[model samples]
Target chain A: MSGLKNGILVAALLALGACTGNPWDDAAGVGGPGAAGLGAGSALDPQSPAYFQQEVGDRVLFAVDQSSLSEAAKSTLVGQARWLTANPDFIVTIQGHADEQGTREYNLALGARRANAAREFLISQGIAGSRLKVVSFGKERPVEICSNEACYAQNRRAVTVLAGGLTG
Target chain B: MRTYLASLAIGAALVGAAFMATAQTAAAQDGPLRIEITDGVIEPLPYAVPDFVAETPAAAELAREMSRVIAADLSGTGLFREIPASAQIAKINNFDAPISFPDWKAINAQALITGGLSVNGNRVTVRFRGYDVFAERELGTGLQFSGTTDGWRRMAHKVADVIYSRITGESGYFDSRVVFVSESGPKNDRRKRLAIMDYDGANVQYLTNSAAIVLAPRFSPTGDRVLYTSYESGVPQIYVLDVGSVQRRVLSTDEGIMSFAPRFAPDGRTVVYSQAQGGNTDIYTLNIETGQRQRLTSAPSIETAPSFSPDGRQIVFESDRSGAPQLYVMAATGGEARRISFGSGRYGTPVWSPRGDLVAFTKQNKGRFHIGVMRLDGSEERLLTASFLDEGPTWSPNGRVIMFTRETRGENGRALLYSVDISGRNLKPVRTPDGASDPAWSPLQK
Candidate 1:
């Protein structure tokens, strides 16, 4: 489960946490978006690094810095609701995010707003409110890597991720 | 009076047109090139750092060589003019005795750097004292170093850093190291590896091999390690590199997620970065020793590029949460966030200055990119440079100048390094062998 040197790791952590003992700080410097959808060749499969069963067409997207549902976003939520309604027992977490063009904390707040925006839209579409959860990445995951306006325009979005499943 | 005023107006218009014409020529093919601090007093300060004169035979030469390098580094920035040893009016007679301020002032040196070195086998101990010329008292007492003799250059830089801090009331950058992606070969197939260099760009050493694509390598305050994003496994992953032994380890392994733009927590233990999951991205932190992952943010918007304030209490990052990419600040522990950028165009690479008063960043307006700085509240925004693209600003330890990447068209499409003072004066090339980007200044060596 681990690779690379052990001493530097210990030293760096000691230096970082020497002042304040914040356990949650472990998640500080992670940025980048890889190919997201579950793939047959993914290491997360039971035969892979870590994998779980995923239903078809399971992800959602958002507009630039907006968590509010547009007509198009509402339509996307309706499609998501149909999937949830058909399954009747799926649990999901909505992760909100901002792009690389704004500040970090505001993006976190904005990411929260966007995730709520999508969650509200899905609930209105008839998905049980409790069956859906929300989280915000705030410009952490970027499908596109460049820093230009074109790339940032696409990175500001909210997504719906399937978590636990309820057996009938 | 009317006729005279017309001639004065005409003369001023001609000068302005000439400058505009040059800018237009640069614009016709590429983008913007302008310097805001057009006029200033640029009289470089003169000081002397004669051979440190180690007390022992083996340490003697090193002391001399190190002092010379320190002198050169200080003068290289064009902020200082070093007095040659040939012009020395008096020798450093004693390391423990009080400095003869009158002797130094007689030579008209506004400042002075005098030190002694004691070589103890493999280890070298250096001690230097700084003087305040007019005050006639010691500005610095014990500026010292105890390190491997082999790293004599770094030791020298450390000495220069101490001298800089004592005189300027600001931290010295000379003692710090620069973490950047070193490049070679053609632009299309250029091979780049994460490398570490002394602040003055000496003793360039590669930290990561070319087997991966490394972007934005940032240094920890201690200067012993680096945090950078690499494409070694064909996806962006945050990795920590140890400077002493040249080893790296992956920090993030969220399946189907790409993690990039890694910056160390001011404390140097954890890191704050962005992770892309599915099609969404958010900022997260990783503890180096313990594989503890805490999700500080949970928004579905794209959040990347997180820089921590010097105190480690807050973080500044770029986001499009406001409908456009702008700078924002939040508590480092994660909480309510506020907007700080209100200029124009897109802004990225917000680097908090070591002085903690300003954040240096890249601002793009009207198709032209600029390197500018603003207060923590996003006020008093000053544009330092304008060019085809001026991004990734790194502050000098003193926060006096900003070093960033500049790219021109044609043969120079590749990025070259340029430097400018915070006042916007003294725009000049940093003299890299080829070109450079992501310039991180080191803390003054104490």
Candidate 2:
């Protein structure tokens, strides 16, 4: 009976796969409405979330599983902080991610530490604490799906996403 | 061996008229009949379970299905082998047929199980008896179970449990459930939701949608509630979800704090998890009823993944205070901690077994991950599996097997659930729709 069920499931998956688009291409940009720019709008305003994500760089990569910011990561966060301060109408959430190297719970904790580290730096640079929220996806979501160190380095990252709405 | 005499009382009502004595019965009365399984390497005991006799026309198909389920449950344990019905020389068409002992013993069948089923309206009843072919006598008294038709599978499991316990002197794990993270979409932006299913990967039910990311769901001692970390509030906070109603409330209600890796204590009323404050992570406990909280660890470094001992006297957790992630043992109240892992690799996610003897964890060394077990003091460490990524192990109800997540590396890397025996044999994959990770096995069914 299990074999019969598995056979049907495989057939259904094959049928679905034929019509589905590449998931990686669809998930390339940052999350949220205007930030994704997938099908939201074609116009690129100087102050739009898409412009901030594409032009100002929405993410910063970390080393392995360490949450401590390196020189290059700090430089990227400085640019992100500057962009957020200029675009005062937008609220941002920092999404922390880790490479698939550690355990699930540990990666979650490590991701939290990384996001909090970035949030503190943004706050130190005079961003309001309420404007910046934090969440950690751990290793559940990875941009580069390879196992080698090259792809893992890209997976360990924290992205700042614009809320794209008016907020006090 | 201890036998249930009450089973004899039940047998008198169900098996007396059907009891069959053969020519070897006189010789069987002079010797004891039993089978004991103590080592890993041994031939599985051979048993026969003919299709049950259906008493009513409405029970014809159900009787056969239930018999198949019971056979699969026993054989899947790798401790028993079922002889195909084609090898049978006799057919049991009546519930109370007289002796046919020679027919079964001819096939070298050491054990034989015979049963009958009856369905009346919405209620179903199954009666079964086990026989020792070598002894040429009934192994145990007959037993019967009556339940609603919807619980037919459970009734089959109950029969298998009885047979397993009577023969091996160990409890059965067939009647349990596992909660895990069901993954879909692409690897870069996977959508995860909590799902529950039978131990054999049947009857799956989703507990939550994939609108928000959820992780590390731990079942309560009674299996009524689950403790997990969700990002629904824009930050990771511990949430307690009721399994029956699909309703949930945030347990880590503290403002401006992120909590993850929540686990229920043996008492089920309290929870222990990690909370990050001021860029520092530490372990904390909360009472679900009173809302009281206690700080369990205050190290400057990170400490998380806290699991309680069966007696609730101690907690085994992972900490990086020693310059690397390692296992630690500390009292429940929190004080000085003793490091338990000194191996070459980094270790995390130390879960204490229900039997209170070994701790299962994931170790990383030489760029390879492994699922391994160790004694309470961290001595006698044994690695069970090695792969690109293997982590987050949960023990079977009997503590004989360990289930963990394994992910293949590449552009199409995906996470899947796998299990292995603690003795490092019988490693196998657990089936699920799409991808799965972070499995939490539930206690035996009610």
TM-score top scorer: 2
TM-score, predicted candidate 1 vs. hidden true structure: 0.62
> Runs in model 2 with CA error above 4 Å?
A1-48, A128-130, A164-168, B1-38
Candidate 1 stretches greater than 4 Å from native: A1-168, B1-43, B54-63, B85-107, B116-127, B133-138, B142-148, B294-301, B333-336, B397-401, B426-428, B431-434, B442-446
Among incorrect, acceptable, medium and high, the docking class of model 2 is acceptable
Per-residue lDDT over B341-413 for candidate 2, one digit per residue giving the tens place of the 0 to 100 score: 9999899999999999999999999999999999999899999999999999999988888999998887678
Interface RMSD of each: 10.3, 2.7
lDDT of 2 by residue, A1-168 (tens): 243543443344344432213111113343322333455545668576656665566777788768888887677778778878898877777877898888887887788778888888888888899898786777866656667786677678887867755431
Q: For residue B178, what is the lDDT in candidate 2?
A: 93
Each model's fraction of native contacts: 0.00, 0.72
Chain A TM-score for each of the predictions: 0.61, 0.72
TM-scores, all candidates, are: 0.62, 0.86
